[model samples]
Each structure stands twice: as structure tokens, then as C-alpha cells.
Target: MKNKIVAALLAFFLGIFGVHKFYLGENLGGILYLLFSWTFIPGFLAFFDFLGLLLMSDQAFNAKFNPGIPYSVLDGSRSAQDITVALSQLKKLYDQDAITAEEYEEKRRKLLNEL
Candidate 1:
């Protein structure tokens, strides 16, 4: 919500520089906007982004804003011990048939990749 507010205010005042895009966590978009703003593209883009933020549904907003950052690792990436414990629990759940093989494999893959 705060990001949206910042984007709105930036759009109102500095839309030409695409500062609004940066506030919305769009680094690439912000860079593009910054580079081409003087050509009028970013001004038009910022106007649309502003309208989208105001009128778009939550699902769309989430889809757009989702960095997919894990809350579990917010304090810093979880230690290997933590991942090991989680993987062990998942193994037990799979063995008990509480979760499907596909789910188990998917989670295992994610955990391995984290290491």
C-alpha cells in the first residue's frame, strides 16, 4: 500500500522520470522509463500504471507486485539445518502418504536448490 502511495505521488510530480516505476519494485521497468522518459513513453506508461494500481483487482496487484520472496527466510536465508529439518518432515509426510509423490518431489527439488 505504501509503495502504491509513493508511486502515485511520484507519478503526480515526477512521472516524466519514471520514479513511480521504481517505487513499485519495477527496477527494469524503471530503468527503461528513466532512459526513454524524455521521449514521452514513460509519461504515458506511468499514467496507465497509475490507473492500474487504482482500479485493478487484488489478484492482479499481487501478480504484478509479487517478488515471490519467502517469509521463512526474511530474517536471513534459513540455515542448512533448517532446510534439512523441513526436508526430513516432508519425507515423513510423504512416507505416510499424507502428501502426493509429485508434491514431495517438488518440495525436495526446491529445498535442494536452496542449498
Candidate 2:
């Protein structure tokens, strides 16, 4: 949620620097966005990013779990380890292409239940 907010702001303001991509832990994606920003690509990409984030679920955000202050703020009422593990697994699966974006979200909600 926080990343999404930051991304929205960056997309609207400092998107050329790809601040939102960095915020999302997408360092490579951010760099790519930055490199092409001058070509007007980043701005266009930011629009899609904004839309994707808007369509993203709270559960999906929770599953990404980058940690820091936002982690506790979003769902501190739940166990941290449960969220951590879910985030880890999701990340692994994402890297492995074992699950689609839709599946990642559903599994995320299930993992949150463990918390």
C-alpha cells in the first residue's frame, strides 16, 4: 500500500527518476524506467504502473512485505513471521514463475491467515 502510494506520487511528480520502481524493490525495473524516461517511455510506463497498483489488492501488497515501518502499520495485528514467510515464498515463486500474479495474490491471503 505504501509503495503504491509512493509510486503514484513519483509517477505524478518524479517519475523520471523511477523513484516508485525503487520503492517497490524493483531496482532493475526502476533503472530501466529511469534510462528510458527521457525518451518519454517512463511516463507511459508509469501510467500502467499506476493502473496496476490501483487494481492491486491489499492482500497482494501485504504479500510483498518489504518490511520496515509500513509492515507493522499495515497489519501489525498479525504475526510478523507469517507475513515474512509468505513474502519469501511469493518472491521465490515469482522468481521461479511457479505462479501467476493471480495465484500469488490468493496464496498471499492464505498465508496471512497463518498469522
Candidate 3:
């Protein structure tokens, strides 16, 4: 779970090194930033990133960074529905014999406990 404040801080401070890009899981963008860091382009880009972070909502941030995962800001955690769906998928895998029974049981217990 990445924090907006942390990403903004990284952009403000170490964005020249593409730290914020890496933090956001944008490896290609991070590498490009690194390649052009000496040209001051990354600094300018980082400034824009800082502004973007300030402007972006938490839901937008999560959607951009976390992708398919559903996040619940009220509890600062994943939604129970997502966990249940994952458990159901795990069961399907187990039924197909894709995973050992022991593995399925362990994962099922872990997922249930998360609820």
C-alpha cells in the first residue's frame, strides 16, 4: 500500500534519481528519468509529479498504482469481496489439481483468517 504523501515526498526530494517512478512501479519511466537526469529534465518532470500528487485523489492514485486490486480507504485495506474472489479462484485451482491439497488448505485457511 503506497502512500500519496510518501510518493510526493520522493518526487520532491529524490525524483532526479527517479525514486518516485520506481516507487510507483514505472520501471521504464524510472530508467528514462535516470538516463536524462543530468539534463535537468527529470527535475522538471519531478516538479510536475509533485503537483500531480497534490491534485490526484486517493482513489485515482490507487487505481493508477494498484491496478486491479480494490482498496478501501475507510479501513485502509483491501475489500473483503476481493479476498473472497481470490479464495474462490484458489478453490478452482485446487479442484483442477493445479495445486496440492496441502497448498490449497493452507491458502484457504490464510484467506479465511484475513476475513
Instruction: Tell me the deviation in Å of residue 95 in model 1.
Output: 33
Task: Note the clash tally of each candidate.
Answer: 0, 0, 0
Would you list the C-alpha lDDT of every candidate in the order shown? 0.76, 0.74, 0.88
**Relative to the unseen true structure, what is the Cα RMSD of model 3?**
3.8
lDDT (tens digit, per residue) of candidate 3 on 1-115: 7778899999999998899999999899999999999999999999999999989998898888877656663354656887788888998999999999999999998878877
Clashes of 2: 0
Candidate 1: the clashing residue pairs are none
- Which lDDT tens digits does candidate 1 get at residues 1-115? 3345566678767777878877777678888889997799788877877776767764455556654534355434787987998899999999999999999999999998888
lDDT of 1: 0.76
The number of the candidate with the highest TM-score is 3
Candidate 1 residue-wise lDDT at 85: 86
Comparing 1 with 2 on lDDT, the higher-scoring candidate is: 1
Best by lDDT: 3
